[model samples]
Target: MVSINDNFHCNGAYVAGDRTIKCWRYPRSHGSETFVQGVQNSCNPVFMAVAERLGADRFYDYMVKFGFTEKTGVDLNGEAVGIIHKKENIGPVELATMSFGQSFQITPLQLLRAASAVVNGGYLITPHFAVKTVDENGNTAKVFEYEKGEQVISEETSAIMRDILESVVSEGTGNKTYIPGYKIGGKTATSEKLPRRSGKYIASFMSFAPADEPQVMCLVLIDEPKGVYYGGTVAGPVMKELLSNILPYMGIERDAEGTEEIFTLMPDVNGMNLKDAEKILKQNGLDVQIRGQGETVYGQFPPADEKINAGTKAIIYIK
Candidate 1:
């Protein structure tokens, strides 16, 4: 969470009215963080300070340069162009909010395309549906092709960004989304609904595998989920689940070597009878412990669809 004191005087005030921007942080993290760590912790103050330094003109130029203001022109139907506030009206407050993904809105596809460019050596390749085609006799036809677009950022900038993004998965809020044997990099984001007073959120995570040379960029967004809504908690696992299957299927080898056990998604045992839930848990190689003397389960720790190490004890609460 940011207080008025967190403002850096490099350019602007950290004002969002009387409301404080509550941010979640790790317990072991010191009160202050570096720029890279800011990416890891998802600190609003750090980005705000950056936006303050960049000011409105440079920030708007970067955004427009990244294709935030125009349609991606992908060969897809119904593509929605993203929205950006006018440069003249973007004052300190507006700039601060926009820096951390508020005030202006971008479509997921747009963000994904831009992200792909960020990691794919700065070339924004148009996304297509097919990678390759096979004929009846197993002869491979040419896969879909897209025009190689212009470079939006420098290779050095992309490399630096990739390293920072990799740090996110290795040591930051995205740690849960890490795969054991692959180099993964990405960012996690949770945006509050417009007007900021509404308690609803849009949780999202964007990832690319084998960070040294990204092959694919995966984007996951969850809207208004129940219980916890942090991007790391909600959207991170969804990305992990997808890549866990996709990486292996695409013949991407695992690079992790150790005794680390494979993780599986926690099953939905809530509202099930105790007998049935226990049976299902056991079938999935999980040890179950009932927390109350009741026949019906009310909840389960680790929650449904979340990845947990195999054989971890699942605590099922009953009432």
Candidate 2:
């Protein structure tokens, strides 16, 4: 088990060989913080230091074990095996950059699979679409199964990671995705596109609901968002919107008490005046997103009578 009290210092940047790796919160030093705090803060120096302790060989081994260097063998064609630095070529700088997810490439599915293993008791599961085929009268015709690979981490370690990740949604950068009465765990990412300093980024958020025992997982990536491109800002809300609808449909009841969110049925605003539609939606505790410049609302999304969490954005189209 990892020690929560293990301390790491972040003095804006970490020096590795001839390179200096700066924290995302550059110029603002976090003098010292425990491992949990470091994770909550998304402090780069803490991860860099941890990678230093693991050394290149051990770190690379973990990467390989996590299925980073190979294709996941998913039930899809033309799946790409992502790139990673060769063990021998990984110097101090390379290790540091890779420690916090850089200097390498992996598909979104690959990352999701690895994340599943981390939270689902460490068993690497093969992802597939079909579960079973049915015959004419809805009778089962054939069953399909996928492999669950060897355990890559101890159950105890997996539990710890789950708790840490849960806190990430509750109190860290991922807090934007948290929904009341639902236990959610997630991580936000803002990946710089190739040809560094190009002012382009992919904002993404990976999340699982009912964090204590995940039933559904989602990975949302917003490619080159127009503005406010931080993952938490751009993708977290999308994940929240998705899970709000999905969890209940899956029959997963909210387990917590005293903090249930207020949900409302979307109202029909079609053919209504824009001001009247806005007033009606606001009365229902919903927000509005107009799609056109016209004053009359010709259409509405979540169209009418659909139940959604309060504060959800209702889109209205005009002609």
Regions of candidate 1 where Cα sits further than 4 Å from its true position:
1-30, 132-134, 256-319
Clashing residue pairs in all predictions, respectively, total: 3, 0
What tens digits encode model 2's per-residue C-alpha lDDT throughout 1-319? 2387898889999999799989888888877988887887778899899999999999999898889998888889999989999999999999999988888999998999899989998988878889999999999999997777978988888888888889988998898898877889988888888988788889999998778898889999999988788888899999999998999899987654612355567899899999999999989888788898888999998879897778898999987
RMSD of each: 10.3, 6.7
lDDT of 1 by residue, 84-188 (tens): 998898877788788788878899888998898888878876667777899999888777667788898879878988888998998998988998778899999
User: TM-score for all predictions?
Assistant: 0.73, 0.81
Candidate 1: Cα lDDT at 125: 67
The 10-residue segment of model 1 with minimum total lDDT is 4-13
Clashes of 2: 0
Error of 2 at 102 (Å): 0.6
For residue 134, model 2's alpha carbon misses the true position, in angstroms, by 1.4
Superposition TM-score, candidate 2 onto the true structure: 0.81
Worst 10 residues of 2 by lDDT: 255-264
